[model samples]
Target chain A: MMVACAVLPAAARSAAGPTNPFLRLPMVTIATHRLVLRPFRRSDAKEFTRLAGDWSVASMTSDIPHPLSEGQARGWLKPGRREVRFAIELEGRLIGGAGYYQRRSGTAELGFWLGREWWGRGYATEATRAVVHYGIEVKRLPGFTSSHFVDNNASAGVLRKLGFEPTGRGRIICTARGYEVEAVTYWLPARYAVQAQPVMARAASAGRWRAWLSRLAGRPA
Target chain B: MIDAIRTDRLVLRPVHPDDAEAIRAQIADWDVMRWLSQPPWPYTLQDAVDFIGSCSPDDLTTTAFAITHAGAVIGVIDMRINPALLPLRGPGPHLGFWLGRAHWGNGYTTEAARGLLASAFAAGVGDTVYSGAFADNAASLRVQEKLGFVRNTETLVFARPRGREFPHVNTKLVKSAFRTA
Candidate 1:
């Protein structure tokens, strides 16, 4: 229910002690060669309206409504408790959005949605990696957690690529489509916060070269 | 009520005022704090004082300890009631911990965690305990899974600071399963 942005500034902390007990970190921009994970711009509203308006993108996400309007996109761009929601952009056009939300206690959760056009591309992984890194290294958050509709294999794949493991599953009534769908839960620890050299090493050595080559070839080569 | 938990290479004891400096040092490291529920950046002596002062065993509902290795406090662990909700009559406590960056990757947390689970069971607190890791946090989840905590559910956490909802994976450990694993 709490919507958080990815680029919240640290200045938002109340000077009145730790009464709130919520820790918010600044937004981080993760850039790959072609994509720029940065704050959403007002100009992006039109593009976001078009992309998120698609039923394909809207169906998988929790809050997004199909036929997303310009006003809706503008509202979505507003900052939340954590940071500004980042417009996942490729070549300066908005493609998706991702950010962290501090829910309760010291825990925070990761969320993002990409347009259907960007599916199969690695932008989600790239942006997610950036946010995860910022959440751990910059915000100094404890961990990042997430879940997706069981049928959303693309989202699940993105989670796996970012090192999130399946933790559990449940059923949720989808408001958008008015149906109950199975939700798959996944989680990831701060790689730097905890010692996970072996896991990291395994992931790194697990045909990373091939993966990287495949990604390169898929690019505008 | 006072006891020392010993693992293969570490000791966890009741946190005392003397451990404030070490606690501050551990929290000051961004790496240690980043994965913690509390922001460890800008940790100061006052935070340590307040944290240690807040560790009241008399409450029984919430207990914390300083992790010691070779006579120095290097980390911390605590089991507390789920702050978001009242403790279910038979549900076990929620566990959380943070070790200094330098001491990580050496199996210290796992060792200490095992000891804590044992202590909790010995105290007859609850039939099962629950814990969680953020979706992007792989290490904490790995530790929980390694210690035999089963996945329970995924939650959309609303971080107030960022003002957004995030996905989280929750895990629980039942006593019977703990003993068996």
Candidate 2:
């Protein structure tokens, strides 16, 4: 995707002020080599339903309802007025989502979920790294709070890989079960978030470099 | 929209502009506002209006109410999901409330909070609700204790009004324990 940005008209590329190298870059849609994290769109409803509606997916989450009704996916895709949410896409296909929700008190929490087939590929971690980057590096949050069902070892692995530490235990509603479930809470400090997956950082920087070169060479891209 | 909840001694109703005056009067006093984490120290009528403006019960993230006794606003009670954390997917709204200084020590805070918890749990909002109180605020802590909130952790939380961090005890109430409590 970064290399693709090299083909844009040079005149348009240079329109961005060059006084600051970073300022010259375009708004990030959160891309890693294997995934693109962007804002959720209404058109993604069908795909979201197909993936997120699965019983396997819904049961693990504390909030997502099993048997997601028709059109409900679109409703979930609606932008939160004050929250940051994103759709995780692979080769332009929607696969999952990740983002933070800021409370009225000005604190925020990190949450994410992915389609079942996409599991075990490290997509959760890579996508999380991108969003966490946006949270700390872009949104400038100090850190985020997260949790997982004590029995959901897969989710625990994802949180652990992202550098989150167990803070304590608590009971939370599991919407899928319509009952409370035991869960372990975790808090990831800003310093750990700053160290999110290096591969994502390298991929993003490489894209910026290509864009920068295109602008410098006065090429159409 | 917020449905009015009637406790034995208080009415918990959705706040509106007309109630702003009473809200300001109650919260403007430092004695009542000292333990609050947000809303500036010197609160004003406009702050009350803005708060009511954002108090829609239909919002999935928050539910705000005016705690009334004998048809007069005495304080506010609310629950909100911490916006920063993304849940695996469930309602985990945190509990918060405050009463006019004069209304304290009468168990009104405890009564109002218990009623709110009952409503939230019945509606399938979550299996548990979380709350916290400044370590020094024995009154607030007592209310939690009376409602059967178990201490989960002790952490330093920022007090926006005072511009400093203070010791606080985080608490959680499990739904199953509601019957026993």
Candidate 3:
């Protein structure tokens, strides 16, 4: 596992070079207190398809139609896109996904989901905090917008715990639901983005040191 | 082979096609690329191949070398014309370099950059060498200052690895002010 990629925003997408635009960045790994947020690997397609494919996982978000196929999962995991995605891994098992989507020149929207089995463990909060921290500290994204389907109180609580203030309510297309669903929207300004206790600093040192040691010992990195 | 420059602690030599994997492993890092002004994110093997293919020992405009220690490619250093900055900054080759994340904090960047700068200047690469780091990249700025690169201005520059245009501290070193040691 080469394990290198970036949380690239829009402008940097094409600056990769003249030789090829088939841009695949090394995965940029994000570690939390108990979880690891990493780039989605090609090998993750099967697990991701099976997990994100569940109606329990897909119906809440604006995208990700239910019954997601392996091919669709593979396509979603492909690099070279404008947004940055991270596979939320807990104890080396893929639990769900989180990332910055709709990345514009300055800000991006936040999104995530977990398999039903993985929900309510505060895993979503921990993973999302790390992602938000990366956005604020690393990407310098000033603001982010997110929403939860009206009935999904779990997501609503997750957003509220993260300091997102409800901006409005509207019927948004839920590709998974196959219709317009009433969604309550919220926004997180930079000020509110600061409280996320990101474990990135410590994780970088521990992870980098471990990775360096492993490489020195000729282990797979 | 012919243009490899030897320093007290390192070897600065032409980037080779065979160095693709090492180059990829090191430069693909966010820790490395976050400060760079150009180049793609996620630096793939093909980009490494293309970069090595574009390098020329004799061409100052595209002078690039692999920094080696113990005969292992540990990093890369290059000086190339920045077409984007050429109009605004004027007549200078932009210098850029990076070491493997594991190799950092060892003063290898200072050592390797010193070696490359000495060679580039001796070959009459240019009268002026332009360099800078992201506003937040203090370590890199420190290296240039140690090399006698005087600070010039600050500008917002777009760097892909950072995923947005960021504040860049621009510096320039003239042939007269160049510190080779």
Candidate 4:
């Protein structure tokens, strides 16, 4: 399925300014020698809905309810108080989501889920690392935390490789699975003191323009 | 005698009986108590004492520590573990914390959270950490997010009191996505 593939216009990618209160640092578009991380677009709604709405994705996540709908996917893309929410772009396609919510506390939580077709390709790990870097270097956050179902070894393995140490667990009601599952917690201390290059400046600039146009057009960014 | 956990900028120790007045004053403020789940209204010194006395190392399930900045206790950070649960039965620990209103916007909670998280990780306590806040509690939620806690889910009916309702934004932090900067 081609899904939504509308490219945001160039004019819409450069109209951002300092007065743009919503404009953050930049959407860190990380390229880890393999994948590209970019911001979400309105066109991505169809595919995002299809992938995020899938029972498989829902089954693994505690928050994503089953019978996923386009409205929910669109709602997920809407800007909230959090600063970083980006689409996991691989080979120029929106495959998943990876970003930080609760941007100010010097620690932002990272969450991401790939479509079933995109599974086993290491996209989740790549996207996760990119976001972690953004949180530490670009955002200058001090720490970060994440968790997964105990049975979701893949998620756990990704966190471990990123240097997160497990510290606790809790019980969560997985609505899609229709049962409670055991979740393991992990944490990573903020050690990015050296300040890396501004990775997301371009994406931020482009995203701001798009957001402005979306507002102008009365469409969501 | 209160055991103190000292960091470069702050000291985390135990809450004492005499500290009750300060605790009461802190929690009684609407800015602080508004986001808290317990202690409805009319917060008193007795409430502070009860809170302190309830915290014991032997409890194993919950560990509450008083946060002190410049020699004065300013807030509290705690870890809640479910002994009856699995995964946690092995190597994971859940965490939660709060700072007094006077201490807001100063990175105190973040400092205290990192210190406690380090202690928990260093001890080989668990493999992951989880925490949450009310959806509207932006500051508390921001602290957890800054620490890399992802949104897990939202609970509709977390707790209800006399003619009042409380919902929670349940968030979790897995080990795989953690990075130290």
Output the number of the TM-score-best candidate: 3
Residue-level lDDT of model 4, residues A62-146, one tens digit each, is 6666787888877767645454666766656677877655433345566678788888867676667667765553444556777
Best-to-worst lDDT order: 3, 2, 1, 4
For residues B1-181, write the lDDT of model 4, one tens digit per residue: 3245677799876556677887877777776766765554667778888887777754323557778888888888877664322111223466767678877888889888877776666665666787767656888888888777887644321121111222356667766555332
Q: What's the DockQ for every one of the candidates?
A: 0.01, 0.01, 0.01, 0.01
Question: For residues B1-181, could you state the per-residue lDDT of candidate 2 as single tens digits?
Answer: 6578889999998787899899999999988777987677689899988888876668534758889999999999988775432121123788889999888889888888988888888778878888878767888888888888877654334465654333456677888766324
Which has the higher lDDT value, candidate number 2 or candidate number 4? 2
lDDT of 3 at B45: 97
Off by over 4 Å in 2: A1-221, B59-61, B85-91, B179-181
Q: Specify the CAPRI tier of model 4.
A: incorrect
The TM-score-based order of candidates, best leading, equals 3, 2, 1, 4
lDDT of 4 at A30: 44
Determine the C-alpha RMSD for candidate 4 after optimal superposition of all C-alphas.
19.1
Model 3 error, position A204 (Å): 18
How does candidate 3 score on lDDT? 0.71
* TM-scores, all models, native as reference: 0.45, 0.45, 0.46, 0.42
Candidate 4 Cα errors over 4 Å, as ranges: A1-221, B1-3, B58-61, B82-92, B157-163, B179-181
For model 4 the local lDDT of residue B11 reads 87
